[model samples]
Target: MTSHKRWGLFFFLAPVVLWLFVMIVLPHIDLLVMSFRFENDEGQMQWSLNNYLAFFEEPIYWLTFVRTAIYSILVTFLTFVIALPLAFYITKVVNPKYQGFLLVLLLLPFWVSELVRVYGWMILLRESGVINHFLLKAGILRQPIEMLYRDSTMILGLVYTSMLFMVVPIVSVLDSLDNSLIEAAYDLGANMWTILFKIIIPHASPGIMSGSIVVFMLTLGNYLTPNLMGGKNSLWFTEQIYNQFIASFNWNQGSAFGFLLLVLSSIVVWLGLKLTRQNLKKVVQ
Candidate 1:
């Protein structure tokens, strides 16, 4: 309302505005332009949708794109499932004095780079790694088991990397919930299942939704974990994009794939919100 407040707000928002434009807007605009055109033999750029059409026409692209989207969603749901109980135990069951300690434990893994964590898993699961060595020493197995490079392994890596993101949000929302509500529900002859489904889940839905959105996007865009943990057999959409950009040097097709991925991921998030009967604004808040 006043010039002083306006100036203050402007100063506060300036960095974010600049970053969004410079980092997101400009790059995307260029990508969108590149997506629609490519230089032909005559050395002229012509607009076309064949880049997008190729995604459907080619089996590899079609399958990989769908697989990546499905896997990302599945990973998001799995993370939520694991996070719910973990968050509940941390926020509702743990003593307030030890809450920070538990959170610190959760955060400890994240302090190092994600690449490091994946490699840690790789080491633990490799044929001659710690787990196999332990198993062999204890006579639990006849021979070393190869544990790295599989869909389940890749999914495990994704879930491990994403757990904190989901748990933190859920814990944030759950901490605000009053224990008295659960007590009252019990007094009114409500069971644990009823109380959880009727009260706790509804109260925590916004946080769950917010966390899901972040995890989904992160998992969808993630390159390293899937590539390394899932091996060369993992046909992730990002790998396809990387091949187009780096391997084949086809920026136009890469841009098209990138744009399509953005659009589809957005749609999936929108549909999720609609199905859950949650508002994006409320979730964000």
Candidate 2:
């Protein structure tokens, strides 16, 4: 390559390389080092496996970790369930002119900050909030129901927040699908279910996998949604990490929790890829 081209390439790549090193690599290295050290009863910092061991030894910590994993999976599944049909409808049934408008509506909520969105849910679901007030006025219920700070409410918040992430990918894949394939399948005596399962799903697998991975990761790492919506009963692993770092001021334990979350999320993504028989390269594409 000519020197000018090489210089152009270097200029283009330099910012990304610097960003990866500065923002991601350095922080992870610092956290990894911190995870192995702890202040003892004597107030002296020492390197040990105690931070990790404590995770295994403490039932609450391990249980919360497992619970967070399960909840994240559930949220991803729920988001997929909600998004798939909506995506299909938007891409397949809706008029082409109106599709963009519908997608804009889906994205409108996200224009606001996530903290604001979660607070919006709090307002709608709280006993004295809109829903309850409406229901009481209509005599649907004599008393206001306790809605906030529940597991279902927390899951609902997660599903709502992550919906667009799941929908956009499915819509992209579905939009590219040729209508002739469905026509051919029908001509070959394939029913709706067969066409959906044998043709549509297979074509959409990459998008589904991509969307699932993104939504799952986001849901798993989310702190504000669970903490604010589920309150003290959330039992989310991220909450534990927050408590360690901010509340208790235990940086070592927080770093360990953070690493553990990273590991758990990796394993879950790996398992998802294996189960779906998806190529990571294709899914990411």
Candidate 3:
């Protein structure tokens, strides 16, 4: 390239390069440094694998990691299930004029902080909350059902929190689907379910993968939802990181845990790309 072209490219890329260094590279370097340090009785740092050793030796830490993985998987699947159907309906069946409004309504929760949303769920799920109150008033239960602070509620919160990410991609992809494809399927006597599974889904694979990856990664790093809804008894990996860094003052273990999560998310992104195996330009068009 010419000198002018090279300078132009550098000018355009400078901000992103600086951002990556400042936000990502710097912290990761710090984590690497901290992960090698060992704290003495005087609260000073030395060098050792004691932090990593403690992490591996504890079964609870491993269990927390597995629990986080399972929760992320479940939330990803649930988000896909809910978002796919809704996206299809909005793109195919809903009026074009109302689609924008409906989508905004679906994503309105973004206006509120996640902490507030979790607390809202808490109110709805609590024994004395609206859900139990309505059930009791209707005589559906003799007593209030225990709805709060469970795996199910945690999963629900995860799904709700990540729903918009799933919906937007699917909607964008489905909106671009050619109507003639479905018409051709129908003229050939393909049933609704057959058309959906065999034709529509294959065409939307890229969007599905994108949405799934986003939801899964977000859920994997999620701390507040699991903490608030799953409560203290629930084993979450991020909580373990928090305990190590804050309570135990073991920055090395926390860094190790964060690195583990980063690896898991990378694997998920790789698998998603492999499964989709479509060019970005084609999907965007």
Candidate 4:
């Protein structure tokens, strides 16, 4: 509260505030403006809603948008299902001495870039990749299976990359849980499932909500893993945006698509928070 401390806080916060405003805020403002405008017949730039209208008018665009949202939600739920048990094991079942080591093991693959990790999957899943090659050599298969470019492969990639985010948050919450609570529930004749459902889940709800939000947003906006793992069959809305901006060089349409995505994803997040009875403050905390 002193002047010197205030100055210190200002110095610490100023750079972050400045960077967000310059790098994130300004560009989004420009994108908003660009999305609402188009060139007229007289070769003049004019404001119009055609960029957004085209999304509803084009089947491919709207369909891809719905597909992306559905797939993102699926990936988020899958990540949670996979992460919850791992988090519980890491927090409650693992030996305290080895817990950090196990955590490190979980983090090891992520030290490398996500592209590298997806490429590792590619190496394992491709037609002549390690898995197929091994099966062929062991006489367990007639020929290499075409495992890549499938929707499952893309979901797998998304889940793998998003796993750490879910796990870390849940682990942080579960680590604080008291063993006495479980013991008390057991003393009252509660079974393992009962304790888990009644005590563990409620205590970890905030972490679960936090992780789900982060994972949902990350997977919704993700471009690399889906594109690489799913290949030409991905049909992700991000690919549509990319095609508009990069391939077709239609910035106006691309910006409209981008804003549409952001808005719809935000609505989904809000609905999730409402359904789960969570709030932004608790999620952040």
Best by lDDT: 2
lDDT of each: 0.94, 0.96, 0.88, 0.95
Candidates 2 and 4, the one with greater TM-score: 2
TM-score of 1: 0.96
lDDT of 3 by residue, 113-144 (tens): 99999999999999899999999999998899
RMSD of each: 1.4, 1.1, 2.4, 1.3
lDDT of 1: 0.94
Residue pair clashes in candidate 3: none
Model 4 pairs whose backbones collide: none
Give every collision pair in model 2. none
User: Highest TM-score among the candidates is held by which one?
Assistant: 2
Candidate 2 residue-wise lDDT at 229:
95
TM-score of each: 0.96, 0.97, 0.92, 0.97
Q: What is the lDDT of residue 275 in candidate 2?
A: 96
TM-score, prediction 4: 0.97
The alpha-carbon deviation from the true structure for residue 44 of candidate 1, after best TM-score superposition, in angstroms, is 2.7
